[model samples]
Target: MNEAEAAVLIALLHARPRKMSWSAIASEVALRGSATALWDECFPPTLEGVNDLDGHLARAWESLEAWRSEDFRLLTVLDRKYPSRLREIHQVPPILFVRGQLRDDEVAVSVVGSRRASDRGRAVAARIAEGLVDRGIAVLSGLAEGIDAAAHTATLKAGGRPIGVIGTGINRSYPASNRALQAEVAKCGAVVSQFWPGAPPQKHSFPMRNATMSGLGRASVVVEAGEHSGARIQARLAVEHGRPVILTDMVVGATTWARDLLARPGVYLANSTAELMDLVDQLTRTAAGIDDWSNVLPDLVDH
Candidate 1:
């Protein structure tokens, strides 16, 4: 693996996934490229609590070997297989462990919400997911409780490829209840994690995982979120990455941020997938920019 890729997996092992800042990571790579270019070239290093570079490198190597043996595959930012949309995000994960198939569908949308979603929120998410999937648009979300779970299930129920990006390890599901859903995702779509196998779900992992959800999608539809929710953070990240943020007032009583997001200059306001599908259809027609990885490392393969 390249140094950046190694660093990213190491960072995940370090439990400091969010610490892989763009400028700092770019500095580490020694690549004379733009921040976006550098992000596309390096993996987020997981070097938590290591004061010495040598010690960090040593721990990273050990983590790499352990991850490799467990069938955990790494897709470096330099890899051609890296998602183009995700590469656009500034806080994107440098290295991702993919457990299943990742489709090259042109239109991908993330459906996100609170972990403790209301029944109405769950129904809406499922409905939105079904509508998107029926149009051949890929549904992406965190495989969490409530709305996220509803979205993934609806997509699979519609016989569509639904991508589930998680904060926990691919081998273990957080909340534990979604284990079967995780398996279905691996079978029908993909179960992706920046965290290595056996990595615990720490408090910070949730927000860190949100960037992946937003980056992987052309637009994100947030059905519900509290004032300072991770879902809300993801909506902002989507805007930062130049993807449209679609806000839905799923509940009768919604926060000011939700209303404000709806009124934002570039953010799209949608109450249902029918309204959002037009945007998905529009984005789906665009061709992905070709990104070749052959020049980066020549021939370095790591699981």
Candidate 2:
């Protein structure tokens, strides 16, 4: 897709109420270009009609362009460089607008918990994140209040990389309180969002944002989560994406579901930084020969 077309596709994806299919995107592109051209730009198969168009390609192109102006980038599943861990999710975001340098040899751990976390819970999150950073792990969070804030702040204080993936635009920080934290994360690590510039946070956006948190990391650590928590959703997504999930006993009164998570294969129960880092180390070691580590490692390191 050309620059203008890519911009238009991004705008349309951002503007549409219902999700647009690839054939629909191709039709839109066909307004300015030939069907054959649109198909070739977005789809590979020979197109007999609109049904043969690839909508995913258009979404991917627009997403890549969203962060192209930044020093880092936005990568789509179509791009060979997109992170493999994230691609394992069924409903993965069509594109991820990333910033900062994605390097090799670092580690990533998603630290998530209740937004209304208790003081003790917040402290645990902070200390764990700090320790993880000390060991060269990138702290990934939703940029929410409570535990999310604690994790990001702790990573920053430890002189480590902390990536904040938001439910809104990178240009717009939600909650209006973490503006300073957002700036710090942007300066030191990366402030990322799938939403376009100026997009406002909606009630549904947070759930969507959790997927990115899980996708960006090799392992996810849940510091605290109540029944019906978004953190649970993130944990499930992490498992579905084939990433290790480390559940902490930080939350009071575990849900039957949460209890079963520990019994599930590949899920570990972590009570300290040692357990968390061990999980991360194992994942990194297992993925040693993989090329996607080139992007995953740097994101996990101390920037």
Candidate 3:
């Protein structure tokens, strides 16, 4: 389909991410003459032809207007400016609400760990963020309290970009404490979310946030996590998304969950920034041989 046609279908699919797969809905939109025709076919028919969807459409326009006023861009899957890495993943969001500008050919590396980070964990997380950003990578994180915050701060300190994939809506900052940091990331890099304009931080939102964070990156680095930490969830999601997951020494040697991860084919253990960078290089080189991530397509997601 043409880009505009595809984006309209993508925007429609956002309402039913799991219920409507791209290939299933694409056939209908692709053959339709225009977006208006496609919408007519999709929206349930009503006696007056007005339908209840007009309400939804009105609210959406309001949201778009709010986004415009704030200069936050809403990226559809087929939009040229959409993050390519995020497009090629299972359950990929059809819409991304983004604050700040996306750098040309941006490459993100997710750095995750426990929010209640140990001293060493915080230090290592910052070191990894600094190392990755120095190499021209955007350090992607959840913008949580401890390790995520440290990594973002270090990336900024190193004069590098940092993308915060937050769980809350683009309009509201989670933890409330990271409000300034959230604004800073938008200035220096981006603060992104798949949630709606005013969605609050629900407990269940973060597991999905982890997957979104994983999809934004070429690879993921788990600097520290207790056995049941959310960082481990992100690492697993990274592996499932076909991205390499780098586990720190503390996690690899101590956590049973991480031991299983280390045994996986694409997972690696790194004790220092040097080792982490080496693994990142190896994984990137391997990925480069297989796919052009910049030209990612919808079919590439489910494959």
Candidate 4:
């Protein structure tokens, strides 16, 4: 089978009958060097009377074709189109369903915060997003309301790329009201999801989405988050992924987690937009090899 077909099969393995976890499948496939080989081993055609598995595979294949017809692209770890930065993370998804385009060379930074953001928080998010765009970096975020909306809107207004990584299936929109915004992001940049095309939003999916968002970006900026916010989860994941985390003064002052995270490497606190932009500049330069990366944040260099 071709890689694409194997990817479909692997995705199928994660469904009802087989019910294998994605991480387990990813690890097995990586070790085996081919999802097709793994699938064949798991369900040998000669082994027997598995009518149910056969039906499920057929249905999944049909869904794959339908998704393709609707302009959705399926990218697996086997595909070169999968985001390289994401592949470096431990929690990398086995597959990604994408609605627009994803360039391997795209330089992005995630701007995340609370869904119930304050006016100042929203303004800060927008300014940071605009500054990121001005520096030619793509803005990445969960397509939720409040701070995420502000950042994405600012990025679009600046005529910059806005990548929306949603918790729901790429074909579905959460909060429902952001459907148009999601479509716009898909048209202007990309809308990405790791779940099946028909999967609905679940309580646990948002944190998973945050982990994926952290993996996709070179850094994550927490504009404003409460102690228990999803942005806080992303901040923690970013640090674990060895990516930098930038917390605004407001966030640092408001949340214990933000203050605690400061003690970790690759984590910085920005008191102003200028300071935030300066750190972004330093990071960009460091990434480009134009400057010493260690000098940007001495502790982070070791990671």
Candidate 5:
């Protein structure tokens, strides 16, 4: 099938499938080796009892065209332009609607934390983001207020790419205040969403967005977050994705979750900007195959 047809079919599968989760649909498509083939098998046009399948396909096509006209790129799991690291995660979205470019080999680190960030936390986030920029790495975040905003703003000022993996649709901005910042990121790097083009922010979407954020980044840096902060969710998801997580001393002292995660493999504690950057540097080296992770964190090694 052509790219457009495949993309539309994936969207239809996401919308029309009953009882099957998007992940399930994605896995089935992967296993079947083609979305078109999966559609033909499960929802053939001549299949009995399948209602309005054609209408759904027509709407999906219209949505795709609308997104394209607005310069939003639709990337399916089948697309070569899809972020390669993201494909490694179990919670990989079936589709991504992106407002900017996504480089398959881009080296990025997620800098995320509490939305109601303390001044010190914001400063620390900015410092960490600037450091990443200096090292020629892109900064990825959820594009929320406080820590996420600080990181993106710092990355922009440092003339670095700022990738925003947002909870809301690529066409909509959450918290409203960051609308301009979202647009700037789209221009400078990317604003990515797994949701359909017009989908609004929902309670469950942020955690899902966090998962994607962790999947996209080389590692996640939690500058400061409280017990219930979404940053904590991203940190946990990062560890699950087998990506390293760097937590600030403040966060560890403030949240039990942070303290609990410290014992996990690939989770590190950073007491200062220097320490954070050192951990990030080690992660970069490990990703490049220049250094072994066990050499960097011997305690994390299995005896």
Candidate 6:
């Protein structure tokens, strides 16, 4: 099948009957045939309870046509526009619902922290975002309150790209206040989700959102986070995805998560914008051309 057809098929598969594991989807695609042929040749028992082959295929096609009628774009793993870096994650989503745009080669850095950020923390997050944009890096964040809001606003103010990886469906707003901000991101950058179009923002959805945030970025910076902050989990997941995690001196001194992250070899500590930029340079170089990001980004710092 074509990429779009395969993508829609996967999207429909997840929407009904039951959601299959991402690895299973990946393996089926590896069979080197069209998705329709794969489905025909190997109908897993998972869908047997729902309907016969013809019935299931019809439902899949119907759902694909329905979603296509909307503005949302379903990207399957087989799509060329699908992000390579995100595929490195342990539990990659088989289908991503995108409402805006995605650049295959842009350098993005996720800046995140507590929803209940201190005033100082908010200021710092904005500063970091501004700095990242000055060097032509896109600012990535969950479109939540506090630090996430601060980062996205600063990115927009700087006329830089802001990628909002959200928990709720692409059409729905989470945290409510970010409704406008999310719209702006869709206008100039991207607002993406793996959830169905009407999926609500459950407590569990945030972690799923964080994983996508961590996966897309070159690295993640935690400006400020309490001990129980979700940013801490994002930082951990970033490291697991083979990206460096940067924390401010303030964050490093604030909680056990920071202290332990500081002990990790790939993690780095920064106290100022200058230091953060310096660390970014050092880490990218030491990553042994994890990507030739510096060469590709002429507007980057030190370029």
Q: Write the per-residue lDDT of candidate 1 for residues 1-303, one digit (tens) a residue.
A: 465455543543353324655424533432443223333333333456433343554677676767667755777665667776665666767667888878544567899999888898898899889888888888999999988999999999999888998998778897799999988988888889876567899888887898888878867888877887778888877766766666774631477777666544446555555665655554454424513211222222110
Model 6 TM-score, 2 decimals: 0.85
lDDT of each: 0.70, 0.69, 0.75, 0.82, 0.84, 0.77
- Higher-lDDT candidate among 1 and 6? 6
Model 6, span 1-303: residue lDDT tens:
264456435643653323555545654554453455455445553554423444655655666778878877877767778887777777576668887888878888899999999999999999989988887889999999999999999999999999999999888998898899999988889998987788898988898889888888888999999998999989888877777788888888899889887665457778777888776666544554664322332333220
TM-score of each: 0.77, 0.74, 0.83, 0.90, 0.92, 0.85
Clashing pairs in 4: none
For candidate 5, the lDDT comes to 0.84
* Full candidate order by lDDT, most accurate first: 5, 4, 6, 3, 1, 2
Residues 46-112 of candidate 2 have per-residue lDDT tens digits of 5464322435445645556555675656554444565655555555565556666544345688899
Is candidate 1 or 4 superior in TM-score?
A: 4
TM-score top scorer = 5
Instruction: Flag regions of model 1 displaced more than 4 Å.
Output: 1-23, 26-55, 104-106, 251-253, 283-303
lDDT minimum window of 10 residues, candidate 4? 288-297
- Clash count list over all predictions: 7, 3, 0, 0, 0, 1
**Candidate 1 TM-score to native:** 0.77
Compose the digit string of candidate 5's lDDT tens values, residues 1-303: 256546655555656566677767776776666776666666665656434455766666666666667788778877667787877888988888888888888899999999999999999999999999999999999999999999999999999999999998888999899999999999999999998777899999999999999999989999989899999899888878888888889899899999999888778888889978988887887786522233456553221
**Model 5: runs farther than 4 Å from truth?**
14-18, 45-54, 289-296, 299-303
Error of 6 at 207 (Å): 1.3
User: Any idea what lDDT model 6 has?
Assistant: 0.77
